[model samples]
Target chain A: MISFQHNRREFLKSSIGLAGLTLPTFLKARAESVGSRIPHKAKSCIIVYTWGGMSHYESFDPKPEAPADIRGPFGNIPTKTPGIRFCEYLPKLAHHSEQLAIVRSVHHKHGGHQQGMYINLTGKDPVGGIKAKSRKNWPSITSMISRFHNPTVGTPAAIRMPYSMYDNGTMMAGEGAGWLGSKYDPILLRTPAGKPYAGVNRYNDRELKLERNIEKRRVTDRLGLLDQLDNSLSHTINGSTPYERLDHYGQMAADMLLGSPVRRAYELEQEDPRIREMYGDHIGGQTLLLSRRLVEAGVPVVQALCSASDLAGGSGDNWDTHRDHFPKMKNRLLPVFDKSVSALLTDLEMRGMLEETLVVFLTDFGRTPKVNNNGGRDHHPGVYSLAFAGGGIQGGLTYGSSDRKGVEPGSEACSPADIHATVYNAMGIDHHTELYDQQGRPFQICDGEPLPII
Target chain B: MVGTFNVMEKLYYIFAIVLINSVHPLQAEPEALRDIERLNGIALKLPEGGWEVGFQLRGQKLNDEDMEAVVRLGSIVSLNLRDTQITSAGLAHLKKLSMLRRLHLERTKVDDAGIGHLTNLQKLEYLNLYGTKVSDEALEHLGQLHRLRKLYLWQTLVTQKGVNKLKNINPKLDISLGIDLTTIVVTNQKSEAKKKTEDLPQLEWLPEEGAKRPPDRSYTGSFIMVYFENNRSKPVKLYWINYNGEQTYYANIDAGQRREQTSYSRAVWLVTDLQEKRLGYFVTDQNTSRAKIPLE
Candidate 1:
């Protein structure tokens, strides 16, 4: 009985692990492009970060044929003008599938949101770090892109709209640039209030705290300069660096506040009010619209996170739904995301920015195939989907098929690094390019391949 | 990303091949622990007995949750951490593990007052020296760890032999030395290794290559990845060919006598301890392909 019990536990553990096993071809292919993709295709990226994970079954990849429990209560609807089917809640993005490429096989080594975020952002495993979450997290791909490629011009390469978030006071994992250092941190825009209004919460207030620090430092700098004093040593010793890579950040911050295209990047009101209304006045919708403005303003990468609060508060904007998933997606999550994502894609393509800008809707991982007694899905990293549209990728195409039971991928399985590699490939950054830590030792930026999406 | 390294790690998470260098990789040499160069590939045999764990490596990604797993497995006795990114802010979490014995804070950001809180850990055996900014003045507060045997005082203002005199006051105490890893070689089991050049299924071509001369042929083991997965159990012929495409075949167990006069094939075998999860090659020729022959 003890042996049987042990075996049962092992099976359950592996069921989660096995899902992360797929996707080598993706990383390898992407790494192969590292040195070769330098003078290439896409030049910019727009990341639509649904703060919480979104339900695959309720949005892009509906399991209409599955049981009622797995399929939830939502029904499918024809999107835009065609045969493409999407959950009724995601009505906006449905019509634009022809321009999007969805990968139902994307997965990774860890299913937890933080771990998944590590894979997505760094294209690597947890390496050496504490799981408690801290402000010293690894950097994001956009940071790497900004670090590698810089902006289209010189307007500070990366931008994050409205605000960057933390979970319950603990820094959210994988949100900041971990090993990449500070030079690549996105210029987080402090959102202003008004209609199609910028949203704020307890989280926003925290963002304000960060804004205060930036302000205080500015005052200290000005006062010290007037006194003809040098506080360089204090800045150097305390901030972990003697002002090497970190030096660029202060200047970048000053540039943003002083106003330039960088200042104008997150301003959505400057856009025709009708267009803003079309995208909806909600927090998520406005952020997506705001992201496009940054891209237009020549920001190479823009990250816009829609709140988990937009759906339900406790679980975090993280889409890890241990329960109540069906109601949330069919009600709050899907409709808002669907409308905003759809608007961004349409607006970009219509403006012809779609060719140069890669728009990605990514989450930590997908929910489970089966629901529990709690009437919701738990974390299911095994088989979920991610969608990519525009920016040199084939459109209206769906790659990789999951098995009939939707328990695992029946077609090609992919790791998060593969998706990250593909993004690097599209952006013309060598996915294989090695990054040296403060020590000169070389570490491969990504080991995964470009999801045969190209 | 999908790669051998990633897959290998997923297959097994218990391995402790963690790479830790000075938090400031840019410095010419790490400020502390210079004697401890590389721990990336070292596997350790964790000892038993004792309950204590503490470290300070500020800013380093400590994977704090993993420590929970480490302590859950058994009692953590001693920790040696010096010149790390872990900061004082994280020290608050360390206090919860009341079972901590000897905490090493060499070159850590922990203040003299922070050391005072650890007074509750009565089981601490050896406290490392010079890891923190604590002065000899702070030694009075550390008097709380009565169970403490030896206090390290290297590179600190505290005279080493002098501290020994103070620690010796405990009549029942027996202070000792501490040690970490020296060397460890981690290799995957045979069942886990595929396409191994050392052991494989055989191919027969002896009479086919009638050279009679062992002098005419050879086998060369590849320096790169040398393994393959095969499932067969028959006596077979293996061969080796040089750059000129000249080949030689050998099956170590010859049924007949030597063909001294005839131009027959000769065999050279690869040495392997074929104990399950393994297949040993026979008569490898240094000039050509690494093929397998029967073990006879």
Candidate 2:
């Protein structure tokens, strides 16, 4: 178990003064409050969900030993780590490999989009069949963080970026606060570019749309306003009412939109010309810069979505690339992503947030071992790759290995639950602790080992 | 050469309209068909009870399926859909406006469908389709609006299109689009940052122990934008207490939406002259994402 004193020392050093006076005071006040464990090392955890299946071939798990058909057509590049290799396009991230570990073998039983996505995201089978969605209402990794670690600091405990959209109006389910209850729900903030015209709008003024595109949220006043509304509108503060939850969420949203000093970080225009240039002129680099800013602001969690621009395409830039996969990965996707992620690792280590800030890159699932008729690999949940760096995770180590054809986990087939369990364990949560389900039934947070990552 | 021919044809029509004392003798003027001097494009709305007044699909969701865009006749009025997902490419065919007034393409994605054809709006007034992609070049064609009074130029590149001199000629015209960045997000006092360090006190607004606080604090602020890093960046949630030690802030909620409905709420905060301190900001998974001011 992690010690409180050592945790506090590391927290002060890693967080770069995030909690300011708040955390130190709370750590001291713990003597009188709950006799609870002071989550010391990094008081937060950030799980990056690279939504659509990201391709390991062009990213982390490049198989240089394989033929052009299997390895696709990208050059293997060296990293700061002695022998670890990345796609040539990922030269930016190559320099920071020392801070990361590429988990080469994570397999699962689900392969369909809905099922694979469900299992990897919720850490369990959908409960119902493919026809029926995951109605089990399992808590997302972020939801658990919000519930178990409501640190007395930061503006939001959990965050998703850009925004998740679905076909028609159906939003991507399983990314929200499932059985964890409403109070622990994450404040879902969508970024919409505004159009200014009229002098009037319920949103305030028309001219004010100038400030419509920044990322910061005003947090303090929002809370105070909610408190005022709560008192004037209701009798007693119910611990678990939709009213309180909505008010709480609304206040969090309003605060983020209005208060947090995060807007500058989100705007790529604010970064130094040289620094921005290093990351390349793209969305991924801008996101990396913003992520760094958030960790600095004392936010406990930050989830940056890593997308393949388009998920369809060669050697497998997006894992599901069916046709025209080769050129797309060779030209557009891999090179851009590589530079940005590389720049991120270097920036984090330079800033020192790498110690407390755990950066994880996880795709929906891996690719098929057998190439399809269209020259693309379909979904292969049997074996995939994930990467974790910083936040106490050991580096330059391959935790598991896949079979020769990359057909399955040859050495150790780690399930999604095991990965989630390892994440919670790294952050000091007892991996086997049973969290309550919606019905008050206890369910283990993760049913796997920590992969001996340390 | 065709444009030249059209210009010559328009001059001939002008001569005939001026020389002949005919009521509806000439269906339309050539210059009205094109050119900035005789144009009035802003109020592209139609007159009531004049023509068939064909249907318009405003505020409806659009898609990639081929759209049948047509307007036979009728004075279209009040396209006051300030915020819709319509694009300039979609609104390309609405150029034949014989009787349109109060065009409110304020938030539609209208572009230079016809920077030259815009001069066709003879009776145009009160034009706002401000947030469209119509650039300052569109302004050159807009010079024909002698009767145009209110022009919505927010979020557009009109100023660069030589509207500075145009505004001088039409001083009565109200031209604006967004926050006019000259006002906010800028520091007049080049020394403002320094001033805050020296003048702005450390507002210990955190209430004293057991001290009774005021009814509450009423605050107003603006959220310029929100960026979700999808995965790595943290969410925004804050908690606070008053001077009397009363909990004043709430905890986490995603996008901070209302539980039952879709909310489009923006917030503003209040700050006194006292030295106020901010605890850490609640971030989600990523390292950091910044929040900006001046609302772009």
Candidate 3:
């Protein structure tokens, strides 16, 4: 495990005196209240989902000895770990490798975009053939966790910020509560599409609040009347199945507008300007900042989708490098990922919250080991890399390995289920723990065995 | 008989004059002059037989194609292509302009590769590569420009080591490195200014006993930029934070000069005077990337 004491010592010895260091109010609050709740081993979980496939060859699993076309353009840089290295573009992250556990041999069978997303998000296969999002799909890991935890009043049990994932035009499956029902779904935290590099806006500004002149009592009376209407409609419609989502929405709206810690927690402007600057003003950076804020406010889980700055405006390429892959990855993708992700890790550690915050990085799948005719790697489900840190993780270690060419798992092969199981383990959930679905059918939360990460 | 003899003599003289005119060569202007003129560039014919080639003032239209014309000016003393589209490939044309004393490539695509083409400019006294892609590697090619007096590398990829190496070779060369930030305003003075907005009371305002509290801290993120503005009328040494969060010798901002650095976020800027005496340390806030520290 990486020791904070050693890091602190290194920091002081190598840096300036911490004179007049008035602690931030938010940090102080997070430190005191994050530990108040007692059920889970970790207080919060922040899963950085690289929605599209980030190339293994260009990132974690580099094959320097492979042919030029296979190896691609970038070279590898040494990390804090003695034997491991990351892509040259990730120099900042390389310094924090000692605090990370990279699993390079994780592989799954699905290669289609939505198929991979479904598998990774839910840690389970789709019930029927792969298709668009449906209520029949399993609840995502976040939604599953939300099912068990009672979130602090005014805050959500789990949250997915900025946006939900979509493939082409269809909303992908496995992002919500699924069969577990909409009540357990991870609520979407909305951020206005600002300039690509303006960082995040004040969190309170983004909160869903009551309209001007809307009295609290009047709102409550309206809710009562709506409930009465909904009751009659349920009878006429034969069940609440059709309006189950509406019921959840009403509850969420009431929770947000009535009184909640969410508005205060979203007040990012209260944060030190230097802190906002540090996280950067770009979409990826700001979203990560929002995630930190959400977790600090007692939200149990936050899934942040990492997209390119150009695409953060809601349209453009992701890590899905189909053409001009080298330039896109080097210029547009990796630089922002390196800065923001590394910033998140360092920020978490510095705040003394790393121990209680499980930081996980995963993607849909890995890219093909060989370069394509377009000088890009196509999708490959044979092998990929995933990483986890904090939440009692044993850092500075590789859990598995890819083959010499990074084409397949070579040893200690772990799948997405295993990775999710590891997260469940960190959150103090048993992988074998079974819960019933909406139809009263029993289902295990995860099937794969959790790796001995701690 | 005398009249006939005079007519034959006149005919012979006319024939001889025609032959002489045909034998003489065409005194055409140099090809370089024509090329420079095509781009509406101004070329002054120097008294020493050298040419001063430049675009009209505020006429930044000359590009790489016009640079090829420079190769014909064997005695070209100066060339200005500021804010032009000339790239590294265009630098090759300057290889034959060996007598060039001044070259301006400001805001161009001149990278490390292009710096090599100017190695033969031995008499080069002034070189401006501000806002280019020139890196530390290009410093090797510049070492031979011993007569270089002024070098502008603002917003470049050149590092301190490269700057030091070039300084060692050409001690007299004055280099203006780092971003030019005269426009950034210094508005916040925490000591004098009252809080504009009162912060809400937080649950975790104070730390409990013996819990290993992180040293009282402020700020967040990965990095921030600090600007040092010399408000004084004389050059003075200033100390600033580095990437590793260390306090070290930053730079000497000449009178009315400004320099900036991108350091790790939350670093304490320990500004020092010319004698290495401590100046007040200012915490880097987030509202602005340019932390203007006006040196009094």
| Model number with the top TM-score | 3
The CAPRI class of candidate 3 is incorrect
Report the Cα RMSD per candidate.
30.0, 33.3, 36.8
Fnat per candidate, as a fraction, reads 0.00, 0.00, 0.00
TM-score of 3: 0.51
Residue-level lDDT of model 1, residues A1-454, one tens digit each, is 4663343333222322232221121121222233344544465798877654666777777778888767876788876545456777776677787878888877665765666656666667776573422434556876877776543112667777566544445445565655566567666665552223212233443232233334566545533432231234223323433232332433343343333455554556677665665566666777778777766655778877766423233333245555446544554456567767877886766444575688887777777778764345766777778888888888777878667656678789988788888898888777887778664667788888898776
The parts of candidate 3 lying over 4 Å away from their true place are A1-40, A129-133, A197-254, A308-315, B1-296
Each candidate's TM vs. the true structure?
0.51, 0.50, 0.51
Q: Please give the lDDT score at residue B229 for candidate 2.
A: 14
The per-model DockQ list reads 0.01, 0.01, 0.01
Model 2 regions more than 4 Å off:
A1-40, A129-136, A151-154, A165-170, A189-254, A263-268, A308-319, B1-296
TM-score of 1: 0.51
Better lDDT candidate (1, 2): 1
Q: iRMS value of model 3?
A: 36.1
Overall local distance difference test of candidate 2: 0.49
lDDT score, candidate 3, position A307:
68
Chain A TM-score of candidate 3 vs. true chain A:
0.80
